[model samples]
Target: MSEREDFVRRFGGVFEHSPWVAERAFDRAASVGLTAGNVHSALCNAFRAASPAERRAVLRAHPDLAGKLALAGKLTAASTVEQASAGLDRLSPEEHQRFTELNAAYMKKFGFPFIIAVKGLTKEDILAAFERRIDNSPEEEFETACAQVEQIARLRLRSMLPGEDNA
Candidate 1:
């Protein structure tokens, strides 16, 4: 594959289903050098410069946290690992039910899945965030969700290209 094509293939899904972000970032990467931190900043710059509608689509592309897709084994491999890292994959039935309810309420309120980078957080931490964020105004929630999406992408990029210098 060509270098751009290979770059896209490696990083395309960094922002959930949004490959365009990676494609755009590759253009910036050509000039900036493709170190992990530069690639991350390039990717995030593309994401932030996108129209609000595009950003919202990226947010909507995310699966609900510990929701039906996870239960049905349909989350993307990255999502599966990230959620599992936070013990979301091993929730008790009661915990699962609580997550389900919170997921529903958050989506209903915000028009997108409640998103928090779950890497180091426990289920209780996630639930607390969900409960608290569900009360944000639409404008506030949109920005918060977008920021969370960026955080998720950062974590994914860091995992793929690990180094203290990458931070």
Candidate 2:
């Protein structure tokens, strides 16, 4: 595979199932030069510039927090690690039920899963966020989901891209 192919393969999951984000970023930067310094910016731009439907699909690609995928051991490697970091992997029966209920309600309300960057948050924080965000209007929730997805992607990219800060 060429360098661009490798870039996509490696960074594709930076936006969950959206490898096109990396592809567009790589192409845009190719016209200039895709250096380590600018790759992150390019990827962010590509994500931000995606069509609304593409952005929604990217948001929908995320699994629900502490939901079935994590229970079934089916989360992607990055998701598994992030969920575990938030102690979402160790919920009690009651906690798990609460998460299940909230996940369903949030999706019903917004037409997409509730997404938060689970890396720095505790389970309590995650739960509280769910409660608070559930009351948001659909438009508000959609924008919030988009922002959270951006945060998740940035954190994942920082780990994947060497010489990149967590900023």
Off by over 4 Å in 2: 30-37
Candidate 1 TM-score versus the reference: 0.96
lDDT of 2 by residue, 1-167 (tens): 99899888877888888899989898776776544446666887898888889989998999999998889999999999999999999999999999999999988878889999988899999999999999999888888999998888778877776666734
lDDT of each: 0.90, 0.86
Clash tally, candidates in order = 0, 0
Scored by Cα lDDT, where does model 2 land? Answer: 0.86
lDDT tens digits, residue span 57-125, model 1: 999999998888998999999999999999999999999999989888888888889999998998888
Using all chains and alpha carbons, the TM-scores for the candidates as numbered come to 0.96, 0.92
RMSD of each: 1.1, 1.8
Give per-residue lDDT, candidate 1, residue 26.
88
